[model samples]
Target: MDTSLDDLDHDYAASIADRAMRAMAEQRIPPTPTNFAVWFQYFAGSHDDLRNAIDLLIDHNRPFDARINQDLFETYVAPQVSAVVVDTSERLHELMGTAKDFLATAIADNHSQIQAISDVAGQGQAGVDPKALVAQLMNELARAASRATRLEAGFAEKTRELDVIRDSLSKSEQRARTDTLTGLANRRALDEFLRKAQTTAEWGEPLSVLLLDIDHFKTFNDNFGHGVGDQVLRLMAKVLREKVREQDLSARYGGEELIAVLPDTDLAACTEIAERIRRAIAEAKITRRSTGEVLPGITVSIGVARYRVGETVTDLIERCDRALYLAKGGGRNRVVTENELDRAEAAG
Candidate 1:
């Protein structure tokens, strides 16, 4: 007897699962569900990028630690996060169409009842019982009232559904734009806000960008592990949130770099704000929670650049980065501005 397709498929999947688990065991990785999924896909050779990344990690003898595992899952798996928002939006649209169709049906039903009443009122022929006509008209009105009640109930249900979906979409979009570690705006959100600010700048409004970097962030991570490093980042984000105005935006610009977008602010004001941030971070106490040890205070290097009229956002960011490079080169915890960068370049 020929083997059934279902059995063959099951056997294939079982073989892949066995291989995936064995590979994780060999690497001494924990048999977590996330790790299993990643390895299962790896063995299946479904995702090219995921497979290549795993292969590279293997070649380098990198440890499959929790952080690396989470990174792999996010880079390969959780990128479909936006798809949730899109799916929710489509569901919302479908619900609206359902509501529209329901309203149209209700309207048609009411019109038919109104026509029945008109027909009864127009009947002037003899032997037409007036009592019977009145009874029929009352029955029609009662039915119409029932229909109206049903419509109201249906609409209320749909409205509740809409509220739920709207909240979900809002949350999804927020998660997509927010950095999970620092609780600050992520790079994507920063790009969007900066582009909009650039539009405002075109009208001659003042704008400034500050790029702040935690001094010796890699050293912190290397010595204290990612947990302590994360605490330092969170501390920096908190300081930034307190220092900047409500109208401004503070975002994590990848890794240990954080940014603030200041609208209607000139170069001097931006520089002052950067100094304030530097001081605030320097004053904040950093402690390692695991060992209850008080670490040294942390400081940041800041680069400030005022937006130039007719310049692209990229240019502004690049100038700010150059100034940041100067600050880091000069010392680890100072503020530099674009004007100073120009002078430094000229002197060189």
Candidate 2:
């Protein structure tokens, strides 16, 4: 019998792992190795910087999105990016030096060949054969041309490789700001949009937020499994994408909740947009892939709240969330606005 296995605190380890996973899932974060390690350390209280950053995000009610996860990985878990950058810079410098030397040699060779042709041309046929001189000039020109071609090809290839690297890095960053499940802007992107929108609102531009939650999503998952639930979610996301204007942003606000940030839109206009989205989602249908059977129509409870000047992002979100709660309490599949909630509270 191995005593080491028994000596380990299996329960504690399991507890920590479970907590980490649930936290990730709650935030709609993929359980990639990088994300999992960051979260595990967060729950285990092993890394001070990582824990504090995550705590601040949570305290602010900020969503732990893919971008935030990558930031944490870079800032705390793997801080070797600066070292990698320095190494890359050194390699680039070395490559430049090699290229410079190669070009210098090529230029010197070409110059010498031109000088020989010039000398031959300058000789007034005293001892030079005309055909021989012509042949020598042609050879010099051919060699110079060949060298130039090779140099051009080498540089062209390197430029293509750099372009490919640039594109890959760009795509990776975009993916970090995108939700894997719904193909919408993740919470990090949403938060950034809200900040800009808040600034615009302070300048007298109207902004609004629409928070939507799928009705009875947990029950739907339990009855039809996550696969069908995912289909329902995708359907809802598609509806949102189609219903909103180009300037508006639709994003996954974590499990079963989606949001739209409407810029330059007032409360009345925002409510209209929210109602349209609600209707579209209710009309959308999803089919179960396994059985090839159509599942039930999806419905969402929507909450609309217009931005107030000088309000924090968290405060605006909380007000919108309260409207959503009212919608849920009133009855599922309805749209509620902050003004309506305010009226109700005042009456009470």
Candidate 3:
């Protein structure tokens, strides 16, 4: 059964990669990383608008680059998050109203019960017939008990509705911040985390970010197919989960790109962590699933950077990315730090 499930996943991924290739060929587009990422989304039916946008761009002979790719993400994925937030907010309002209504009903019911008790007490002491007073008290008690039971039922039903709404909102929020393929935090999540981390880092602890690029990823994708390419990405995510602290976060930044956010960390510690990840990737074996054939394992280039006080999220990300570029330039499968890059240039 496991093997069958694996085959299903393998075939599914292969189909996606195959469709991506077709899209590139059909549009006469270059098989660049940006184009590949875009077409992959197109093939996956992520959004009708994404497909239409790509078609329009191709028709206009526009270049596919980071700007266009980012635009696509902003259009399709980011908006859903906002919509979900608004929808969730509205649901919360309804929940609040329900609670307020319940409170009002409870207060009114209690007041009625109090008034009934006062009337019975007055009648009993003011020379009213005993039989009449007893009957009146019994009626008031039954009314109170009936009201309480009804209110309890209403509370149960209304609270259940609120629970359902809360759950829906939670799932929507998760979807907004999660990468579909790797099940890691998405780029949006990373951006948000960086922003908050920056604030906390100013007064509390240091923050660090790492940018990782799979070495020769395009060639690997072309040779071993997208199934293996996805396998490689998932493996990277797994290592990140295994090695990083619970407080740290790992996310898929984009195609063949991953980000790690570390709180209470410095450059020295982050660099050491990056090196560990690099070495782990180098040492792990990757095998072809279908034939059980041992294939060549892949490595990654990583860049480490520390968040500076008052630095924007973009600034931190760019610094880390620059270090990653330097690592790739220094030769793939190595880790580089922002300080190291600065020192190298100064020495040169």
Lowest-sum lDDT 10-residue window in model 2: 1-10
- TM-score of every candidate: 0.81, 0.70, 0.80
Ranking by lDDT: 1, 3, 2
- Candidate that would win on lDDT: 1
Clashes of 2: 0
Q: Report the alpha-carbon TM-score of model 2 versus the true structure.
A: 0.70
Assess each prediction's global lDDT (C-alpha) against the native: 0.85, 0.81, 0.82
Q: What's every prediction's RMSD, in angstroms?
A: 6.3, 7.5, 6.7
TM-score preference between candidates 1 and 2, better one: 1
Q: For residues 125-187, write the lDDT of model 1, one tens digit per residue.
A: 545888988888889899889989998999998999999898987888898778777788877
Query: Model 2 over residues 1-348: C-alpha lDDT tens digits?
Result: 111213449987778789999998887665666687778778877677778899899899997754677678757765533454565567667667867877897789878877877787876366778888788788878887888888888877766766765676567668666877789897778989888889889988999999999999878877986667777887888888888899989998877789999999999999998999898878766778888888877789999998898889899999999999999999989999999999988989
* lDDT, residue 176, candidate 2: 65
Please, what are the lDDT tens digits per residue for candidate 3 over residues 132-234?
9989899989988998898899889888888888899789879877876678898778878877788899885889999999999879877887678888888
Model 2 lDDT on a 0 to 1 scale: 0.81
